[model samples]
Target: MVRTADEASVFPDVVVASIQMAPKVGSKAANLKRSIELIEEAAGHGAVIAVLPELANTGYVFSSRREAFELAEAVPDGESASAWIDVARRCKIHVVAGIAERVEDRLYNAAIVAGPKGYIGTYRKLHLWGDEHLFFESGDLGLPVFHTEIGRLGAVICYDGWFPEVYRLLAMRGADIVCMPTNWVPMPGQAGEHMAMANTLAMANAHSNGLNIICADRIGTERGQPFIGQSLIVGAQGWPIAGPASKDREEILYASINLKETRRARHLNAFNDVLRDRRDDIYDPMLGTGWPLPRH
Candidate 1:
């Protein structure tokens, strides 16, 4: 974990708050109201950047595509996004939230970054989990980074964290910090083990890319699905700076990230200098092998 004194002395200070929001099952209006309350709370705590969990405006569990579609809304025009924008403008803070987006007839699990300046950008989930494939369409766009009052920020939805490539791509694209908003469910068997996965991903990605990684996960039960709220902030040195909270009531986690340390780490360690070490020419087989001898 990066110390506060070290962080204050090194880089421009930015306070990030991760909100563990509890969405009302299938109620967009109620969820939006609750999100606004959380945003105000974060702003009151002096947070420059605030992040909410994936599918925060509506519960993640759905019986069918119709349910997901019913909750989906347009980018800036959506009720959720508009409410978030209003809160951001009033609080003078930058906000990142995940929502079910409606593009024509198809639904996409999307994350939108809204601020006092209005909607900044949007990122749809690239990887869908299991039954999600049957409803939401996978995002095709690559990882993106945006310049804000707090500095360069990268946004990634839930399942996107499972892949290291997204982190590398964002880091290579000049993302100083990556913000992940997730609604991860704790299955029948795995209760507290999900934190390990989140920690490993945050540490490895931060260590390898020399960038800060902040995550916000949902809490409480929704439609019988229990979420493990392990919202946390990891430093550029691949260590937890703030949390690894367990599944419980809604909570807000705060941490300060040093941008200078990120640059220093990258300069000292050549992990981000992938061009000098990678051999792409010989790795074509990893994509697919043409080996075929027998046909049924």
Candidate 2:
């Protein structure tokens, strides 16, 4: 319920709810039901924005494209997304949920943002991880931010969070907040390591770009692979306002984001200004002709 200066705001703070739930593999109806329950709970709590983990509607780690496609659904026509849209409109909030999208005949790891106005925007997973390349098509849609009642929201699916350039581009496009719906697997003893990486990504990117970064990661073990749920909310200063918790239970992390802080941080550190300091003219060789080095 965070409101800007121009609007008469009821809620002065921006509340974001990040959901961590286990998705039933290939069961669209069950997944949709769980998503709806979480969305309703978040909305009831007066959250202006709610984010679910990547592939929330379908468990990740599919063995074949057919399996992935079987779980995929059309954009707005998809029952899961459509139901969330109704909830968003009814609750008057913004929702960002991940789904396996069936685009014509191709399948994609997609994230859809819905509000009272219906599906506002969609971002397909730009960076596939491990065996993902074998089952889904990489998204070509460029990084773009969507203007919503909450604020300028940008999204990057699970694997895409590993990249820095994406955050830079989103920041350049005037994103107040960036959402990452991730499915990070926790190695036997590497939970701390994974959380550190996620924290670094959130803090470094937000502090440098002067944008709020929220990540909703899946919890619990799926197919015997443990997922460490560390859903968090980081301010523009790269500090965790919410969490970096373990994966034993489901919890809602809330933070009141002040857009004014972004401007203040940028004024003080101004790391984004570094982008303007770049000399593209001198780096032309980096974008060299399409040729591989000679394999002598």
**Model 2 lDDT per residue over 1-296, tens place:** 44467643632457888887777577778877888888889888888898898999888878688888887889888788788889888888888999888888888888889987777989999999878887788997878789876678999987787787777677666788888888887544564455656667788878776778888888777666677787888888788988875566777777778665554555554454433444556754333222232111
Q: What is the total number of backbone clashes in candidate 2?
A: 0
**Candidate that scores best on lDDT:** 1
Q: Which stretches of candidate 1 lie over 4 Å from their true place?
A: 1-11, 187-189, 192-194, 269-296
lDDT, residue 123, candidate 1: 87
Provide the global lDDT of candidate 1 against the true structure: 0.79
TM-score, model 1 to reference: 0.86
Score each candidate by Cα lDDT: 0.79, 0.77
lDDT of 1 by residue, 78-110 (tens): 788888988888899999998899999988888
